[model samples]
Target: MSVRKILVPLAGRAEDVEVLTTALSVSRAFEAQLVVLFTRPDPTEALPYLGDGVSGQVIEDLMQAAREGADQASGRVKSALTKIAGDAGVPLAEKGGEVKLPSVRFLDVTGRRDEVVAAHSRLSDLIVFGEGTTGVAGGTALEAAMMSAGRPVLIAPQKSWNPVGGSVCIGWDDSAEAAHAVTAAIPFLEEAKKVTILCVGGKELDPGPGSTLADYLELHGVVADVHLVDAAGRAAGEVLLEQAEAAKTDLLVMGGYSHSRLREFIIGGVTQHIRSHATIPVLMAH
Candidate 1:
């Protein structure tokens, strides 16, 4: 499938520049449309009933703070988007149809950040995230996107970078998620200067995923290097990061391994770990 639409959530964090830049880069490479959001954190979600004797001023103070924060976030995101778009030569086109540069637009959403992101993500083909607000706030948004969007999520590192998929590493496994990730990443894989399929442990090596994926990639005219590592009781996410670092890969493509919570939401294990600790960018799918 093609990456024709990308969604990026701006949480008013410091690292949003990296995430937004990455999204624009991908959009440029794929001629995709970009949808950005600065989700307003809902103060009412935690507004407790402070009893009948509660002071109205106290409630007003809390509400004011939340709105002020949201307003600041919106301003910062708009300013950054404008600068990035200018640098990339994207016109401020209101109705898309920017053939030379990616079309960009922002949504003014009000709700719990995570819920707002998940609901809006349903319209995107891919969701991109930067280092998430340095807390569960980012984690919750990532989880919501993965669980609800039924698409891929590209999580960027906390640090800045320029990874145009010139070199890539694939964290290989034999699950459905893994297969989906590979298919979802075909565009980048095809353009990569170097591509490696990495497998850890016996089960992953049993089907010779490294070779299998290499062969499959070969059909698309993408030459890939297959490498295997001993799991040694380490988490798959950790092992993949190690191999990616060793190979000096620009990007890591992997499956988002997750379990359903409340039978409707998702809480990922490897996906969450990699998203949190990765120094390079990760492209994930479920």
Candidate 2:
């Protein structure tokens, strides 16, 4: 399905601006409305923790500081969205004979990050999150946004990415999440001239599931090739990367399989490996 509306969770960080730009590009290509959301922590939630030792004046000062921080973050997010929209030729207003360009709406939300994102997801066709700019925290935010939103999330790594083109790689395992990822990625797959479904496992494991997905794609008139890797000695992530490199793939579409509630911990084997080391951009769905 085509994405008609995209939600981008902005953190107002420099790195996140790049991710927002990429999201805008995708939105423009799809002729979609881009909703930029930023979350501000609620002030009332902080007052309960203030001890008796901290006077009323002190608490008020702290609250004011927090509000100021939120306002600053909101301004930065709005500025970035405006800049990107202009870059995409989305005009702010009409001139004498010129048509005004499409504009993005910046939403300043207050509450928990996950909760805010979840609410926005109900109204958006897709959600885009940036891989954390600061080590583990950033990665954790990206993962949480995807899980909480219950929608497709495109995670842009810290490394450089060219304009996404060429063959698309689908990391298949036949799970429900894999199915969702495949369905969510149809827009990209339709544009890709070539598509590859790669399953890294042995004969003892399931193979028919991926084949069925390939057949489904064939029904949709998409030309896809399926490959099964034995996973002889290398890790699954390593094998997947090797194959992607060999094929010169620019984007990877796969189910983000994980069981950890706190994604910052990196508890699961496959999830940990892919989050920390995947070389290509991953379109992940839980």
Candidate 3:
């Protein structure tokens, strides 16, 4: 399906601009609505961290501060969203509510950060995330979105990225997760200037897996070149990266999955390898 709405979880913290801008880039690629969900920390959680002598008034004060900070930070977020959406100096007041500017919308959601994102993402076509910019929710919200939202997520690297769809590479596998991922990534593949399906494993490329997917992409008017790569004892993730670099791919489409996903992240697996190593953006749908 076409990506019509993208969910970007925003914690009124640092790197908000970077994350929002990355969402904007993806939104522009598909002319999708950028649903910016601002997740503010619950002030009551601060009580434990407070000094022993602190009272309810201090709690109230912290709540007030959080509200004020959220307002100010959200304003800046809207301003930056408008600017990056293409029309700058549009006056912050005009940029407040929903405008025709960039299909940009905002919602102030309170609760656990990941829960909020996963809840709202049910209506979104895709979820976009920054590298590791975290707040009170910590950094695992992306994983929550992936596992709970039942949708695809585009994870942007730490550095700035633009024109994310051009020159794409797919890490092809026969897993259900891999299949779902490629389908979720169809919009990006359709928009890419060049599409390369990199088949990892020691097997030869055939009509069953990689070539079959290539054929399916062709049906959608996406011409892809399928290349089989022998891992040669190397990790599948490493093999995918080698091909990605060789092809100069800006984005890699792969399954956002792992058996015991957490264990895969720490021990050794394709997910872990790419999560730790890939230089380009990875669009994963689990």
Query: What local distance difference test score does each model get?
Result: 0.78, 0.74, 0.76
> Whose TM-score is greatest here?
1
Indicate which candidate wins on lDDT.
Answer: 1
Worst 10 residues of 1 by lDDT: 258-267
Q: Candidate 1: deviation at residue 282, Å?
A: 0.3
Question: How would you encode candidate 3's per-residue C-alpha lDDT over 1-286 as one tens digit per residue?
Answer: 7877888876555666766766777877677778877786677776788889988787788889987887787777666666665552222223455554347776776677878888887888888776554321125677777788788888776666787889999988877888888999888888899999888877554647888898899999999998888888888888888889888888899886647676785677887677666677888877
Cα error, residue 84 of model 1, in Å, equals 1.6
Local accuracy of candidate 1 as per-residue lDDT tens digits, 173-238: 777888888898999998899998888774445646678788889999999888778878877777
Q: What is the lDDT, from 0 to 100, of the residue 279 in candidate 2?
A: 63
lDDT of 3 at 116: 85
- Candidate 3: which stretches are off by over 4 Å? 12-14, 45-54, 86-101, 134-138, 203-207
Model 2 lDDT per residue over 67-124, tens place: 9999998899989878878777764432344432244677888998777777778767
When 1 and 2 are scored with lDDT, the better candidate is 1
What TM-score does model 3 achieve against the real structure?
0.84
User: All candidates' TM-scores?
Assistant: 0.88, 0.86, 0.84
Error of 2 at 223 (Å): 0.8
Angstrom error at residue 140, model 2: 5.3
